[model samples]
Target: MPQSKPQESPARKLLNILLLVVGTVTFLGFSFGPLFQALGPSESPEASLVTEQLRAQADGYRAVLEREPDNPIALRGLIDTQLQLNEPQGAIEPLKKLVELEPENRQLRAFLAQIQQDTGDLEGALEQLQILHEKDPKDSQVLQELADVQLALGRPSQAIELLENYLKEVPEDNDVRLRLAFIYVRNNQTEKAVALYDEMIAADPSDFAPVLGKAIALSSATDENLRAKAPELFEQAARLAPPKLREQIRQEAELSAQRNQPQAVESQETAP
Candidate 1:
């Protein structure tokens, strides 16, 4: 008998929404590439009316919540109002109540985690994401967020291990693989970073990410031979890059060539 696939969790569904609302930006050192656009708060009240109107809305929601503590609508309204008022701390208790109202709701849990992250409560965020990861190890969005929290906590080795283990199960996930390579470069494992980029390039020669990633990895290498090859690869990557990115990669290539030129001249002048 064929088994049915599980429905997407609310937590995963809100990755784009809640992560943005909290302003959690993920950056890979050299940026293999942007995976998604910057998503954030929905249309907000104008600056002039923000304080007066939003604060009144927040108070209304609070009054309702005081009468009916488990009211999801009031809880959500309060959260939205507080967030719009730029008072994330004020949103926390209401968010906690919402999570308690539906302990099985992954979306609420994920939202709480993001709010915690935004509030600089990284350990709290990590604890929430850890539970999500344990419940769904193959949830790529959860895995990525978990790894991001690990990175935010200054645990690159742990982030690398988390991504690496997930990659073993889903080897074709280029996004995760690129993230892993970025970590390797950041951790000073340039050889490993270069190797991973080579693998990605071999898989798709026309893709500019690994090409640019390899160029970046090589450009930072201690090996002169490796560094010497960076400018040429950068140029190759520029040719393969999208029209929007082409100019930036071209400028990078030019800068790399200029930087290497003085070293090349020094080597030539000193040679017998």
Candidate 2:
């Protein structure tokens, strides 16, 4: 009996199956993406917990201060939170209260000084350090820290004096010597700086800091005579330094040589 109905195309059926598979994949992705994100591994659970706890404690202290604003403990707690959070500016008010309540607390005073230093309030920090130094004149740590802060405040002369006085008691202190060299450099006494570096190198020739410092200082000298000495210092530093720094020192020496040639030519031209 007559021709049978043409069979439905297999291509149409395959296309329908492909559409169904894609639709299912889209549905699954949309549903699971946020679920996986919510359950992802956290990068800093401990810090997050500490921050949350501090916030809660801060809020509690704030509420207490709202009711009894003069409470010294509440003020101290708020100051501690601010310090932990690295918001030293925010700590100033509570610290002022703590200082008023406990003027004799040297630890509190030192903490205030440190926070002030961290916040760039060097004058305030210096005042606090002076008071602390008066209380404990023999504290080398305090002296060193104060000297460093003074240097940061553009008082390298004071830093040098402090380091000198500290070295009188703690002689053989290489750390103090290093700090003194830094102060000398800051004061533009490159000769003194180089001398200190030389002393340090004589004591421990293997130490790279002094050698590098000497090389750098010699490379920056203004006098052509002095500038001629830089390549030797750089070669010495290159030998003593690690591979990475050795390459850098060699490059600097080459550049310094290039710079010196022009100056030498200029001087020769000016000669009679």
Candidate 3:
């Protein structure tokens, strides 16, 4: 008998694909960049014709689904047709049905969650994300996305807890760590935020992100001693920054100095 090739797991396949295509991380570690290139709607003269054809196809899929509600083929066709038509709302129903039918399919669940997020059904997205997280808590992409959804829903504490737990298991994920620090800054937990940046700097003093993050965090502090450190940190960050960002960091340093001057004089006059 001939040997059959082993099928690759979806998660492993996703990793292989991302490894081949992943690009630069954003300054704030906001994203790991695109997973796939988006194919925007066509603007050519045949655009109307394309739209008409898609609508007809969608109607056909809907008719088939009406007769055979459990037909995965019709469900998938309708989902694709709705997405290409730029009507994500229309895709949600069929996608949900498909997801229910294939509860064990990770890719399908992730796709459905993304569609829910895009269509502003954040609660729905959160539900799906929570399920994914429970299944694989250490998935960096899922962790970041789940945290993002929590923040969007005005639940910073929940986001913080999620990141903190994930970090305990995967402390080396600097991107998620950076994102957690950014969240602390936004939540006005300045000291905690700066501590995270300090840890990152201890790990890699040459890295610009923690340097810049610490500078900004301290610069906003009300304590004179804390606020006083911002200018020098900002200066260091500017030096560490690339040429394109150097001027902007330098400008921040100058502003920090100006803001701290009044407090500096007050502390000087009050000295023993």
Q: Point to the candidate with the largest TM-score.
A: 1
TM-score of 1: 0.75
Query: How many angstroms is residue 255 displaced in model 3 relative to the true structure, after the best TM-score fit?
Result: 9.0
Question: Each candidate: what lDDT?
Answer: 0.70, 0.65, 0.74
- lDDT tens per residue, model 1, 83-113: 7666777878888887778777776777777
Cα misplacement distance, residue 87 of candidate 3 (Å): 1.0
RMSD of each: 8.9, 24.3, 9.6
True lDDT of residue 247, candidate 2: 70
Rank list by lDDT: 3, 1, 2
Candidate 2 local lDDT, 1-272, one digit each (tens): 01122333333222222222112212111100111011123459887787777779888888999999789878978876765654568787778678778888876776677667656687887898788887887776567667767766777788898888877887787656665665576577888978887898999998666765666666666777777787787788778766655675576668667766764434345667
| Native-to-model Cα distance after best TM-score fit, residue 228 in candidate 2, in Å | 4.2
* Root-mean-square deviation of candidate 1: 8.9
In model 2, how large is the Cα lDDT of residue 49?
83
Q: Which structure among the candidates has the greatest lDDT? A: 3
lDDT per residue for candidate 3 within 90-206, as digits (tens), equals 988998898899898877777777777777898998899899989998788788878878987889999999999999988898878877887787688988988998999999999
List where candidate 1 sits over 4 angstroms from the true fold.
1-46, 254-272
- Model 3, 157: alpha-carbon shift in Å? 1.3
TM-score of 3: 0.73
Candidate 3: segments with Cα more than 4 A from true spot:
1-44, 223-228, 231-235, 241-272
Report, for all candidates in order, the number of backbone clashes.
0, 0, 0
